[model samples]
Target: MDELSDADLERYARHVILDEIGEEGQIALLEAKVCVVGAGGLGSPVLLYLAAAGVGTIGLVDFDRVDRTNLQRQIAHTDAAAGTPKAESAAARARAINPAIRIEPHDVKLTPETVERVLTPYDLVVDGTDNFTIRLLLNDACYLMKKPLVSASVVRFEGQLSTYRAFEEGPCYRCLFDAEPTEGLVPRCDTAGILGPVAGVMGTLQATEVLKQITGLGSGMVGKLMLFDALDYSMQIIRTRKNPDCPLCGATPAITRVGG
Candidate 1:
């Protein structure tokens, strides 16, 4: 078990007060390692809240630079950071929020060649990337590597969050969508225009799910999918099941390796 310092006790006073996440839980958080795949909108709140909660080590992977448009939803970056790499900017914000934690910045795109190498070090992975190619790759990689994956996506006013323990008889992302959609088939936020707060809400919920998974605080979204409709102010939880034909986690897996 990790020991909390006098300063740690004070800094996480609220968490320590909760009976569910007492000193031991706080210590677990301090010893946990999490990797966040994107530093954009969804990654922003996930990174910030996890850092504030004192997650011991965080890995950020993003190759894009902070753009002017990112300011609206990517709260971790600012106007001055417009030209900076998203991973670097998000890392700076995480460090600022909790200087005690270690932030590893991988200022590179998530590719088939680097997928396993990038995700192997962490205990958990949060999928915040916006594209289908990387999303598919992450799902397969996590299933193969046996890492828990917290995945969520936001478009316009709709967002979905789900946790996968596919390695342990639970459903994986591939169970929901077997194959990546053709390019340009789905419009991105950059083209469709997403409400900033919707992404924030999903990302924040993603952070909560991460904390829950790490500390074993409560029932997680292992076999469920949460849907948030910000436009209608409604939410729904849908149960998911593993597909025997799932290419990644099925009875006879076809994809035995990344990019296979």
Candidate 2:
């Protein structure tokens, strides 16, 4: 908990003026450490907003390169960055947005072998990855590390967001999804033809949940799920409870390690 400096006060004037996020909240934001996985659709807004909010440190993890197709929704990258690594591109944009913050780019794919080493340093983890395997890996690792994870996904016209703090009383991602779906069971946004703005909506909501968790200004999405249907322009939040049968966070927890 550090005090806000003159530059911080000026840079975050609007946030400082808000009753929910006054000087102290701004200070909290400045001291927070967050890791965002993926630099594609959902991660674009997550990184930008978190940087503009003055979060002191951010870890960016992505191994892919930016392509022309990514430009439609990955706002953090431009034509100039095409063919560049996504993590590096996102880090550059974040630095350009707020020079005061520190952005660490991990240009490597996250694996069961590497998950803990990559994610344990951060206080919070935001999951914007498109794969179910990575999502499950993050959930287990975050639960084991006692780090909060804000996860969101968008495919076609549908999106979902939730926060998992399984070290507490709430359900982990595995509680909602006991195991990874079979290969090809879930369609990728690229193949399914996702609307660009749908990813933005989910990513922005993911950033909002991150800020709320950091500032402690309001109730978070823990133990709840937010579902969005972009086609119908409707949203709904449903309660999700810890499952006693969940292997990761249940009474008889069996997921003792990242890969186990």
Candidate 3:
């Protein structure tokens, strides 16, 4: 285990002063490994906060490249970074925020093969991907690997956050949304247009859950889903339970592997 240097102590003074996140929590953060599945709007803030909190190792996965349209909410990528891989650009921004972090970038789409290989190394997984295919794949992968999965989604003015740790008796993502939404029914940020700050809110919540999980300082979102409606500025918590018939985590156990 690496000890905090004098510079680190000064930098995280406020964090160290907090009762919930003192020196011990900071050290736990420094030793924790987290994997983020996308580098778009949600992934942007999640990566930024986790890096600032001194997470020792962070894995970034995104196949998309920075585009002019992404500047609206994807704060990590700048105009100059246009055409650069999103994962690489995100890593660069994260490094700029805190040089002590070690960022691993995978400039490739999350597929069955890559999900297992990339996610297996991390202690926790954060889902910031837009598509359902990748989301389901991640849910299954995290379940099989017994890794904590902190997930968040934002669209238009609404957002949702949840934590899934199948091994710990909490419900997995599949228990809530058994399958993907019908195609063309749910619009992507590129298609429907998302409010910038709304993404930041949900993403930051995801990072909070991740930090809480790592330090065991606060109650995690596990077994419940938090919903945010930006327009109304209201929040609701819905209790969730693991589906005994869930194909992935259920007794029948259809899913055996990360991508199976």
**Per-candidate TM vs. native?**
0.98, 0.98, 0.97
- Please give, for residues 25-134, the per-residue lDDT of candidate 3 as tens digits: 88999899999989999999999999998998999999998998878999888999999899999999999999988999988878898888888789999999889888
lDDT of each: 0.92, 0.93, 0.91
In model 1, the runs with Cα more than 4 Å from the true position are none
| Candidate 2 per-residue C-alpha lDDT over 161-252 given as tens digits, one digit per residue, 9 for 90 to 100 | 99999898689998898766788788898788789989999999999999999999789999999999987889999999999988989889
Can you write out model 1's per-residue Cα lDDT over 150-254, one digit (the tens) per residue?
999999999999999999867989888876688888878999989999999999999999999999998999999999999788999999999999888888898
* lDDT comparison, 2 vs 3, better candidate: 2
RMSD in angstroms between candidate 2 and the native structure over all alpha carbons = 0.9
Give the top-scoring candidate (lDDT): 2
lDDT of 3 at 234: 99
Error of 1 at 195 (Å): 0.2
